[model samples]
Target: MTDRDLTALLERATEDVVERDFAENAWAAALAARRHRRRTLLTGVGAVAVAALAVTAVQLGGADHPKPTPATSSTTSTTGGTLSDGTAYAVMPQEGTEGQLRDFDAGLPSTIDVRARAEAFSAARPPGSVVAVYLRADGDDLLHPVLVAGDGRHVLMGDVDLVRTTDASGNEATPLGPRAVGGGGRYVVFPQRDHVLRLDAQTGDTVSYPVPAQHVEWAGWNAAGTRIVARASEGAWSIDPSTSRAEAVPVVGGYEGTFRVTATDALPSDVRVTRFDEDGRPLMSTPVRGPTWSLWGETVNTETLAATGAFFDQNVTSKVIRRGYGPIYQGLLVVEPSSGAAKVLLAPENPDGQTGRVKGCCTVLGWADADTVLFQSLGSHGRWVLAWKTTTGEVFEVARITTSAPDDPVTPIALNVGRRS
Candidate 1:
C-alpha cells in the first residue's frame, strides 16, 4: 500500500478508538477529591484532639499539617501522667472562651476546690518553682488563677475581680490579671483599693498588706521574685511581702540579681536598651534595631547580659505600623546588654494573625534553661510551647497545649522559668 494511504488508514483507526480527551478533567477532579478528603480528615482529627485536651486535663500538641516532633512536658506530675512533651507555657482563656467550651458539653467541672488543687500541686512541686501562672475562665468576670508546673499539675486559685474600677482618689486603677503573678510562682497578688491581697500557692493562704499610696496597681515581681512591686499615682514602690515593709523605688524593668534591663518604645529607628543596677544606676546601654513593639516581652540572662526581644516590625515606627502596614515582620531577637549586639534568632515566614499560618511564630516566655529559651507559638492544633537553644540554634516543639475552648484558644501568660526535675 502507498505510504499516504497507510497513514490515512491509521488516522481513521485512531479516531474510531478515541472519542474525547478527559485526562485533564480526570486529573483535576482527582486532585480536588484528595484535597477535600484531607481537609475533612484533618477537621475530624482536630476535633478529637480538642476533646482529648478537655478530657485528659492538658494533652497538648502542635500543627495538624506539619507535624512537629512531640516532646514531654517540662514537669513531672505525681498523680497525673506525664504530658506529651515540654514546649509548655502558661495560657489564659478569654472570659467567654471557657464558657463556650462548657456549652459545647466538654464536661468541665463548674466548681474546683482551689485549696485542694493548690495542695495537690504543691505536693508535686515546691513553692517558688512554678512553670506557669495562668488565668482560666470560670464562667464569670473573675478569672481563676492557676499555678501550672512543668509536669502539667495545676492549682486553681479562687476567682478575683478583674473589672477596672476607680479608686478613692478617682484614678482608674489597673484591673487585676494574669500579670499579677509573682516571679517565683509562690504568690499571686491583686490590688484591693488601699490593700493588696496576696495568695500563697503553697499554704493556700491569703494575706492583705496595706499600701502607703492609694489606688495601687500590681507591677509584677522583681526579677528575683523577692519583692513585689506596685505602682500608684504618687510613685512606684517595692514591698517585701515577708516583712510587710514598703519602700519607694525608681521604676526599673526586668530586675535580676543586681542588674536590670530596660528598652525604649517603638518610636525611633532603633530601640535604646539600658541596664541598671538595683540602686537605679545605669551600668550599660545598647541600641537594638527592629521591633516596632516589644509585646512579646523581654527577660535578661544575668550571666551573659543578653535579653530576649519579640518584635512586630524591624526598624519600623509605631505610627507607620498602626496605619495598616504591609508585610510586617515578627520574630525572636536576642540582645546583648554589654556588647550592644542584637541578633534575630528565629524569623518565621508569615506575620502575626496570618490565616493558615501559626498565630504568632514566637513570643519569649522565658529561658527554660540557661541555654534554652522557651517561647509560645499558636497553630491549627493549639498553643505550643517551643524551646530554642541559643548555643546550637536547635529548635524543637516542647509541648502542645489545647485548651478546653478550642475556638477562642488560650493566650500564654508569663512562663515560669523554673523547671523542676
Candidate 2:
C-alpha cells in the first residue's frame, strides 16, 4: 500500500479511538530509552492500535517465526489480597485463569471530588493506606490522573493537557519512570510545567517543589525513601520530601540496605557492577557477562540483583533480519553483581515472543520480601503483576489487568507495588 493510503486506513480505523497518537517509531525510541534507564537504577522499576498496527509492522518487518509459550507457573497454595500499602491483587491458579482480577476502571466516574474522597480515604482507611495513581484517557488530547486504591476506590487527581507546554520535550504522553508511584507507595509525583507535584496519598495533600526549568522529570525516592530524585534544566538533584530541599548530586544509582549499586560496560564481554559506601566511595566491582540489559535493586538482599535481557546468535541465515532492536530472546535474569554470578530465573517459552515487544519477561516492580520479587509480565496469558519466589522458583499471579477494548483509555500509565522487604 502507498504511504498516503496506509495513513488514511489508520485514520479511518482509529476514528472512534482516543485522540492520542501512537507512533511506533516514537514509542520504540521511548521504550528503548526506558529500558536503558532500567539498567541505571535508583532501584526501581499501551494501548492502542496502535496495538494492531504495531503488531502488523513487526510481522511485515521480520521473518523469524518463533513459536512462543508461557513461562512455567507454580500453582502452589498461593493466597492473594491487599498488600501493606493497600494495593489489591489476585492469585492465579492456572495459566488461563483471571483469578480475582477485575476491570480496575470499571464504573469509573468522569469527575471526582478530590478533597472529599481524600478525606474519606484518610478517615476510613487505616494507616499505611495509599491510593495508586494512573493517567486515564480523557477526550482526544488530555489525560486525567486518577487515584486508585485496592478496595476499588477511585479519586481524580487532575487533568493534564497534552497540546500545551506541560512537558518540556513537547511530548503529549506522560513521562515513564519509577516516580509515578513512590515514597513507599505513599505518594505519586508528576510534572507541572516548572515544578514537580507531589501527592501525599496518605494525607490527601499535595506539595509542589519548584525547579529552575519548564519540565522537571522525577525519578521517585532515593534508596532511603526519604528524598526524591530528579533531573531538570540545571542538573541531577536529590530533593528532601519533608523540607522540600533540593541538592545536586554528582551521580545517582540504586541503594539496597547499606550499599549503593551502579553498573557500567567494562568491555563487550561483560558489564562491571560497582558497590559504593554511603559516602560515595567505591568498595567493590564485579563483572557480569552476557546479559543484554541488567537492572539492579529489587532484591531480597544487597548481594543479588534482578534484571531482564535477551540473547541472539551472531549470524542469521533467514531472508529477513530483525529490523529494529525490538524485544528478542529475553527473560528474567537473576544476577549476583557482587560475585559476578548470573542465571535465568524465568523466561518465556519463546524468548522472541510477540508480547516481548521492547520489554522482556516483565518489569520488576519491587521486592515483595527477602525471597519474592514482584513484576508485571505481558505474554500470551495477558498482562499480570506476579510474585516470583527466587528461592522456590514458584510463580504466583498477584493481579491481572483488564481493559475493555484495545483502545480503552483506562490503560495504566504506571504500576505501583509496595516494597515490603
Candidate 3:
C-alpha cells in the first residue's frame, strides 16, 4: 500500500493513543520514514505525534487492543428451567428434566417411537454427566442424533431432526438419517431438517441458515467454528450464520472439504511416514515411520500430529519399520522424523498384565489445531470415552458413551476431523 494509505490505516488503529506506550518512539520513526518516502512537504511532526499516540494507546489496552484468551471448544451446561446465561430453555419444567425425560416424548411421529427407545436406547458421556446424544427407535428405519446433557442431577434433552439425506445414486432427499454434529466455541453446529443448525451450547438458543439446495448432505464449522460450510447434491457452499449468507466456494477440491484452520508451524511431515504405491508396493520410507494405524494432522502447518497419546510396548525391529502391531494397547506416539524420536505421552493409568485391554485406546480423532489432537479410548468395557491431548502432553477426558460391560465392544462414540455425508 502507498505511504498515505498506510498512514490512514495506522491512524485508525491508534485512535486512542495513551501515555503507557513505550514503543512510541518506534512508531514515530516508522511513520517519519514513510512520510519522507511519500515526498510530502508536511513536516514529520504530525506523523511523529500520531505514532507516539498510537503506541501509548496500545499499552493502555484500548479498544484497538483486544486481549487474547485460550480457545474454549465446548462447555456442558444445565437448564434449571433456563440456561446458564438466563436464556429460557425450560418453559414448564424446561421440558427436559430427569422426571420429564423419564416421562419423555419427542412427539416426532407415531411412526417414530421415543417411548420404547427411551427405555432401551440411551447415550451419555463424561461417564454420567456431560454432552450426550440419543436415538429414538420407531417402526421406521430413520435415526437422528439428539443432544443430551446433565448437570449432575437433571438430564436436559433437545430435539434435532436429520431430514436431509442422500441416496446410493447420490440423490438428495428430505428423510430421516444419521446426523453429524460438530462443535465450535460456545456452540454446536449440525445439520437439521432443512437448514444448518447453530445451537448455543450454554444458552440452548438456536439460529439456522437455510440450506443452499434441496438437501444439504453434509455440514461443519470452519476450524474455528466461526463459520459454517455445507454440501448438497448440487455443490458445496459456505454459510455465515452471523450474517445468514451462503455462497459457493471452489469445486475442484470441493468446498465441503474446506474448513478454516488454525495457523501452525507444525507441518504434517511425510518425513515420519511411509508412502506406498496404489498397489500397496512400498515406495518411500521416511525419517519417522508409523505403524499400520497412524494419523497425520491437517495441512497449512496450523496443526498436525505432534505425537501419539499412547505408547506401544514393543521393540523397534528396525529404524525403517516395526514388524508387527503390539495392540497399541498402551497408546500411540507422535514420532520425530529427524532422529526417529518419539515420546509416549499417553498410557493406561493402571497397566494390565494379562487379561488387560488396550488403554490410550483407538485412533487419533483429528487435530483441532497445531497443538491439539482428539482421540478415543474404549478400554472400559461398558464405556468408551473421547479425549484430547495437547502438545504439552496434557490430556483431558471430554465425553464418553455408557454401555453394558463387554470385552471392549465397539462404542458408538467417535471423533473425527471430518466425516463426509
Candidate 4:
C-alpha cells in the first residue's frame, strides 16, 4: 500500500477501535490482521516502488512500530481467599490485608502512627487471612485521618500521635526524656525543640532533635530507612539518620500529595512541572525529559520518559509506548527494570451509565514483583476486579472482589501480590 494509504488505514482503524470501545485484546487482534495485510501488499509491489514506499511506510508509522515481545507468563497469583468472616475476599496486589473486611462485627479500634519519615509503607499479616493493607499518607488534614485498612482481621495501622505524659510522681517529664505511651510498646522519646518529642514506631528508640518552632511536617523514609524526607521552614530536605547527613533537594510542588520511593530505582524522568499561583491557578507549566535512575538495579532507562507535575495538581501527564500497537492512550506504562522493556496496560473508560460498555479505569495499583504489575478496575455497578500483567504481556484475571456503595466510593487502600509462599 502507498504510504498515504497506510496512514489513512491506521488512523481509521484507531478511531474505530476507540469508538467501538474494543478491549486491549480485541484491539491487538485487529491490529495484527491489518499489519499482515500491509506486509502482503508491500511484498507484491514492484522493487522500484518498494524502495520509496517502504521508506514512506516507515516514516509514517514512526519508530514505535517494532514488534513487541509477547507477554510472558507471570508466576504471580492474585487470589482473594476467604476472610475470617467467611466472606470471600477480593484481593489486589497489596502489602497488608484490611481488618474491617474480615470481621465487621469486631470493633477493633484502628491504630494510627506518625512515622518519622513520609514514605510509601505497606502492612500485611503473616498469612491465613484476608486482611492485608497498604497506605500512602500525604499531609492533608482532611485525608490525614484516613484509614488505610479497616478490615477486621489483620490491620495495618498508621497516623498515630506522638504524645507526652508523666509518672505517678509529680516530677515533670522532660521533653527529651523517655516516657511510656498507651498502645505503643516501649516508646523512645526524642526532643524536637520546644518540649516536643519524636518517637519511632518500628523501634522504641527516641532522640532529641531541633525542629522549627512552627508546625513541623513529617515526610516518609526512602526505600532504606537511612534517608528520611521532611518539610520544615527551608522546605523539603533528605536526612540520613545514620550519618546525620542532610541535604535539601528541590521541594516537591504538591501541597498534600503522598511521596513514594518506587520499589524500583526509576527516578522521576520526564517530569512535567507545573507551578501554580497563590489562588490555586495555573501559572507556569514545563516538561523536563531525561533518563530516570532505577532504585532497585541502579540502572538508567533513557528509552522513554515518565511525567509528573512539578507543583501540586489534580491531574498529571504520563507517556507509554506499546509495540506493534503503537501508543495506547489513557493506559499506565511501566518499564521493567530487569528487561528495560515497556509494558502498557489499558485503563477502563469512565462508566457513562452504559451497561456492557466496559467503562473502568486502571492504575498500576501496586507491584506484584519487579516484573509483574497488579491492576484494579471498577466495573459497572461499582464492582471491583483485579488483574495481573507481566512485562511480557500475559494478562490474567485474578478475582472479582466487591462493589462500592454509590454513597461510599472505595478508593484503593493498598495493593500488593506475590506467588503464594
Best by lDDT: 1
Whose lDDT is higher: candidate 1's or candidate 3's? Answer: 1
Candidate 2 residue-wise lDDT, 1-421, digit = tens: 1233222222211000001111111101100111111111111111101000000001111122222112232233322332222212222223333232221121112122222232134434522433345554456556555555544455554433322123343433243333345554567666555666666666667777775566553344433445555544344445566653554343444231223223332323344445544323345655554333333212222224433322321121111113322323334444445445443332323223233322233545544444455555554545555555544344554444544432222132344433311
Q: Candidate 2, which ten residues in sequence have the lowest lDDT sum?
A: 48-57
Q: Rate the local accuracy (lDDT) of all candidates.
A: 0.38, 0.36, 0.29, 0.24
After best superposition, candidate 1 residue 181: deviation in angstroms?
A: 5.9
Backbone clashes in model 2, listed as residue pairs: 48-51, 310-329
Tens digits of per-residue lDDT, candidate 4, 1-421, equal: 1233222212211000000111222111111111111111111111110000000000111122222121222222223222222211112221111111111101111121212122222332311212122222344221211111222222222443332222222222111110111111112222222222333333323444443333332232222222333333334434434455333333443211111112222344332323322212233434322222211101111112211101111112112222222211233333322222222343323322233212223423333333333343443443232333332343433323332242233232222122100
What is the alpha-carbon lDDT for the whole of candidate 1? 0.38
Clashes of each: 14, 2, 13, 47
lDDT of 3 by residue, 89-134 (tens): 1110111111111110110110111122221112433213112233
RMSD of each: 21.6, 16.2, 23.5, 22.1
* Local accuracy of candidate 1 as per-residue lDDT tens digits, 198-299: 766667677766667666644444444556555554555566665645544445432222333333444543455555443333465555443434433333
After superposition, which runs of candidate 1 have C-alpha atoms over 4 Å from their true positions? 1-130, 149-152, 159-185, 190-196, 210-218, 232-234, 247-268, 279-284, 289-295, 298-302, 312-328, 349-354, 357-361, 405-409, 419-421
Any idea how many clashes model 2 has?
Answer: 2
lDDT (C-alpha) at residue 284 in model 4: 43
